[model samples]
Target chain A: MSQHSIAIIGVGKIAVDQHLPVIAKNPAFRLAALVSQRGIEQAGVPTFRTPAELYAAMPDLDAVAICTPPSVRHQVALEALNAGMNVLLEKPPAPTVSELADLVRQAAARRCVLFATWHSQYNAGVEEAKKRLAGRKIASLAITWKEDVRRWHPGQEWIWQPGGFGVFDPGINALSILTEIAPEPFFVTAATLTYPANRDTPIAARLTFASDAGLPGAALTAEFDWRQTGDQTWTIEIVVEDGTRLTLIDGGSKLAINGNLTVAEPMAEYEGIYARFAGLLDRGESAVDAAPFHLVADAMVVGKRETTDAFEW
Target chain B: MSQHSIAIIGVGKIAVDQHLPVIAKNPAFRLAALVSQRGIEQAGVPTFRTPAELYAAMPDLDAVAICTPPSVRHQVALEALNAGMNVLLEKPPAPTVSELADLVRQAAARRCVLFATWHSQYNAGVEEAKKRLAGRKIASLAITWKEDVRRWHPGQEWIWQPGGFGVFDPGINALSILTEIAPEPFFVTAATLTYPANRDTPIAARLTFASDAGLPGAALTAEFDWRQTGDQTWTIEIVVEDGTRLTLIDGGSKLAINGNLTVAEPMAEYEGIYARFAGLLDRGESAVDAAPFHLVADAMVVGKRETTDAFEW
Candidate 1:
C-alpha cells in the first residue's frame, strides 16, 4: 500500500496534542514536514518556519493538515490547493463562509481534495445519534456547552483574538453534533448573542432554529459560557416526539438515553477525522459541509447582541 | 391560456412603484388581491391585513408577490409557500441566507415555486455586458454602489433593523449582478462592514472577492455608502488585460467603456421581475439564488464591527 506523505501547518495546541499523536498512530499517513512560526522541537519531522519552505523541502508531501487559526486559514489553504496538494482543515473551516466557499471552488477547479472536518461529529455517540435521528421527527434540542477555556486552552491567546470565535470555540462542537443528528436541515429563526464588554466576539449565544415544516422545528438554544468554575458542562439534550431523549455528554464520548447509560468510548476525534479524510482521498471525493458553519453565520446576522461581563485571560 | 390571479403583499414603496404596476401590465398575472397592514390605496383590489389572512382568503390565488421588509419576509414566504402558491420575492430574498436555504428546501419539498429576483441585474445592459465579457480574461473589477437612503427610503426603519441588511440592502443588488455576470464563482476575500452606532445593522461595507483562477480573481471591491449626493452612483468597472475598463452604471441601466457611454433600454426592473416570475410559474420551475445573501451573512459574521456616525429619523 502506498502511503500518503503529509505536512502539518500551524503547529498550535491542536498540532501538538492531537494531530501529532493521531498521525503517529495512523500508518496510512507518513509525516513529511511541519511548518510553524515557532519551531517544534519534535525530532523525526523536518520543521520549517513557513508553509512555502515546507512544501519546497518536502516535495513528496501529498497532503497537508492545516491547524492554523481561522483568520489565516483561507490564504494558507488556497496556497496549498494551488500547489496541487490535498488539505485537511479544522472545524469552522475559515474565518468567513465566503472564504470557505472560495477555497471549495478553488479546490474544485484545481481538482484537489479538500476536507473540512468537524471533529466533534466523529465522537462515539454522534454517529449512533445520526443513525437514530434519520427520518425521525425531532421535537426539540437543548445544548449546554459551558467550558473552562483556561483549563482546556491554557495560554492560547489566539482563541480570544478577533477571528478566534471565542465561546463558539466550544459552541461549534455542539453545532457540528446538532447538524449531524438532526433529521431535517434547519436554520436560525432567531438568536441573541452575548459578547463580553471588552471582547471582540461573543462569550455566549442563544440560538433558535426552525425547520422547513415550521412545526416548531427542532428548536436549539445553546449557552456557551467559558467561565464555569467547577463541574464543567458539555452536554446536548435532544428530545424526540417519540419520548426518546438522547443526552450526549462528556464531550460526546458518553451517551445516555432516557437517563440510562449506553456508550463510553475513548475520544479519538482527530484520528477519526484523519481516517475520514483518507477515505475521501481513496474515493477521490471532497467532504465539505458548510451547513453547520452556515448556521453560525446566520445566527450571528439574525441574533441580537448584548453586552456581558468582560472576560480576561 | 388561463391568467393566474396573484396577490401583492406589503404594498410599500417598492410595491407601489414596481410590483403593482408590473402586475397590472403583465397579461399572465392578474392582480386579484393586495395585502398590507399599512393599507394600500390601490383601486379595484381587495386588501387584507396580514399574509396569513391573505393566504386564507385567497386559496385560489396562483401566485403571491412578497414586497415586505426583509425582517418578516421569511415568515410571509413560508406561509405563502405552505399554502401552495407560487412566490415572487424581492432582492436579498430572505433576511439571512440560512433562512433562504430553508425556504428553498420547503419550496422544493412542496413542489411550489419561489423566485428570488435581482432587479438591478434585470436592467437592460447587464445581459449585454455578460455577453461582451464572456470568455475574455477578466483581470479585475471594482463595483461602486452608493446611494442616498434619504432620497430613496426616507423613513424606512426596517433597513436599520438587524435583519434589514444595513447598507447591503443596495450592496446585495450589486452582488446579485456581479455573481450573475462573473465567469466563475467568487467568494469575499475580506470585508469591512461599518455599522452606525445607533443601528443594529451595518451602514456601509467594503467587500473584496476572489475567483478560482490565479488571475487575482477579478479584484471586485464593492463600496456601499449611503452618503452619496446627486446623480447617484451604481457603477461596476471591470478592468481587462489591455487596460480597457468596462463600467456598468445606473444599476446596469447603462454601460460605458473607457468613459464612453453605451446605450441601454429604459430601466423597468419590476416589469422584468414579474415577467420572470410568471415564466417560472408557467414552466413549473423555481429560481432561488442565495449566493449573494450568503456572502452578506458571512461578511457580517467575520467582519469586525466599527461604529460610525449615528443617524436620526
Candidate 2:
C-alpha cells in the first residue's frame, strides 16, 4: 500500500494527546506537517503557521486531519478539500448541521475522502453492541452521561459560549454510539435544556426520543450534565422487545448483555479511526453521518430552555 | 386522468383560507375528507375527528395534505404513510429536521409519494428570480421580513409555546424562498436570536450567512421580526457579481431586476402547490427539500440568545 502523507491542523490538546500518537502508530499514514498558531512543534516534522501556508509549502500532501475546534472545522476542512487533499473531521464535525452538510457536498464534488469520525463509535464493544441490537425493536433506552467539566475540559472557556455545545460536547459521544447501534432511526421529541445563568450554552439537558419504527410509548430518554465532581458516569442501557438487555459502559469501551460481560477491551478509538480512514482513502469513499449531529441540533430546536445557577471554573 | 382522492387534516386557518379553495378549483383531485377536532366542516365533505377515523373509513384515499401545526405534523403524516397513502406537508414541514427526515424515510419505505410543499417557492417571480441567478455568484444579499404578530397570529397561544416556532413560523417562509432561488447552498455563520422573556421561542432574529460557493466577503444577512405595526415588509434584494440586481418583493409575488419590474402576478402559491402534488403523485415521486429547515435549525444551533420584554396577546 502506498503510504498517504497527512498533516494535522490545529495542534490542540486532542491533537497532541490522541491524534499525533495514533498517526505515529498507523503505518498507512506518514505525518508530513503541522499547522498551529501557537508555534507548537515536534522533532523531525515540518510545522506551518496556517493551513494556507502548509498547502503552499507541501503541494503534494495526500490528506489533512482537521483537529480544530468545531467552530472552525468547516473552513479548515473546506480549504483542505479545495487544495485537493482528503480531510478528516473530529466529533460533531461542524458547529451547525448545515455547515457539516456543506462540507459533505464539497468533499463529494471534489472526489476526496471525507471521514467524519466519532471516536466513541470506533470501539469493539460499540460494534458488538450494534450487532446484538440489530433487527430488534428497542422497548426502552436510557443514556446517562455525567462528567466534571473542570476536570475534563480544564478551563476551556469556549464550552460556556454560544455554539460550544456545553454538556452536549460529551453527550454527543453517547448519541453517536446510539445512532450507530439503534435498529431504526430515532428523533428528539422533547428536550429541556438548562442554561447556566451567566453562560450562553446549556450546562445540562434532558431529552426524550422516539423511533420511526415506533418506540413503546416514547420510553427513550437521555440526561446530560456537566457538574459531576466525583465518579464520572458515561453509560447507555437498552432493553429490547425480547426482554434482552444490553449495556455499554464507560463510553462504549465495554459492553454487557443479559448480565454477562460480552466484550471488554482496552480502548483504541483513535487507532480505529485512522485505520478506517486508510480504508476509505484506498476505496475513494466518503462517510458522513449526519444523524448524531442532527439529534443535537434537533434538541436545540425543540428544547425548552431554563436558566439555572451560574457556572464557575 | 383519474382524479386523486385527497383529504385535509387539521382544518385550521390555513386549511380554510388556502387548501379548501385550492382543492375545490383543481380538477386533478377531489376533497375526500376533513380531520379536525374543532368539528369544522365543508358542504358535501365529510369531517372526521381524527386521522385514525379517516383512515378506517376512507381506506382507498389516494393522498392527504397535512395542514396541522408543525409540532404534530410528523405523527399525523407518519400514520398516513403507514396506511399506504401519499402525503403532502405544509411549509416548514415538521417541527424539527430529524422528524422530517424520519417521515421522508417512512414514506419512501412504503412507496408513497411525500411532497413537502413550500408555498412561497411556487410563485412565478421566485421561479424567474431563481432562473436569472443561476450560474452566477452573489455579491451581496439581504432579506428583510417584518410583520405584526398581532395581525398575523392574533391570540394563537401555541406561537408563544416551546416548539411553536414563534417568529420563525413566518421567517421560515422567507427562508424557503431563499433556499429555492439561491444559486448555491449557504449556511448560518453567526446569528442573534431574540427571545421574549415570557416565551419559549424567539420573536426576532438576525443572521449572517456564507455560501459554499464563497460569497463576496460574507455579505449575506437577514433580519426577521414580528414587531412591525404597519407597512409590513417581506423582501429580498440580491446583487450578482456582474452588478445585476434582482429583487423579490411582497413575499415573492413580484420581481424586479435592476429596477425594472419583470414579473408581477396575483399570488396563487397554494394552487401551484396542489398542481405540483398532482404531478408528483402521477410520477410516484417524493419531493422533500430539507435545505430551508436545516438552515432554521442551524440558526438555532449557532445563534446567541438575548432576552427582550415579555410578550402578551
Model 2, residue B27: C-alpha shift (Å): 2.7
Candidate 1 per-residue C-alpha lDDT over A1-313 given as tens digits, one digit per residue, 9 for 90 to 100: 4578899898988789899889989998888888988887578877899888876776667899999877788889989987789999987798887687778888998989999999899999988887777887777778888878789878777666555677787888888888887777777767788877787777778877776422353465677778787889999988877879889988788898998878889998998998887788887789888878887888878777777888877
Best by lDDT: 2
DockQ of 2: 0.75
> What docking grade does candidate 2 earn?
medium
**Candidate 1's residue-wise lDDT over B249-312, tens digit each?**
8889888888888756799888788777778888889998777887788677756666789977
Q: Which residues of candidate 2, in runs, are more than 4 Å off? A: A56-60, A212-215, A258-260, B1-3, B37-40, B43-60, B212-215, B242-244, B258-260
Q: What is the C-alpha lDDT of each candidate?
A: 0.81, 0.90
Give the clashing residue pairs of candidate 2, or none: none
TM-score for chain A, candidates 1 onward in order: 0.94, 0.97
User: lDDT tens digits, residues A183-246, model 2?
Assistant: 8888898899999889988989999997854355848999999998899999898888888888
Q: What is the lDDT of residue A294 in candidate 2?
A: 93
DockQ of all predictions against the true structure, Cα-based: 0.50, 0.75
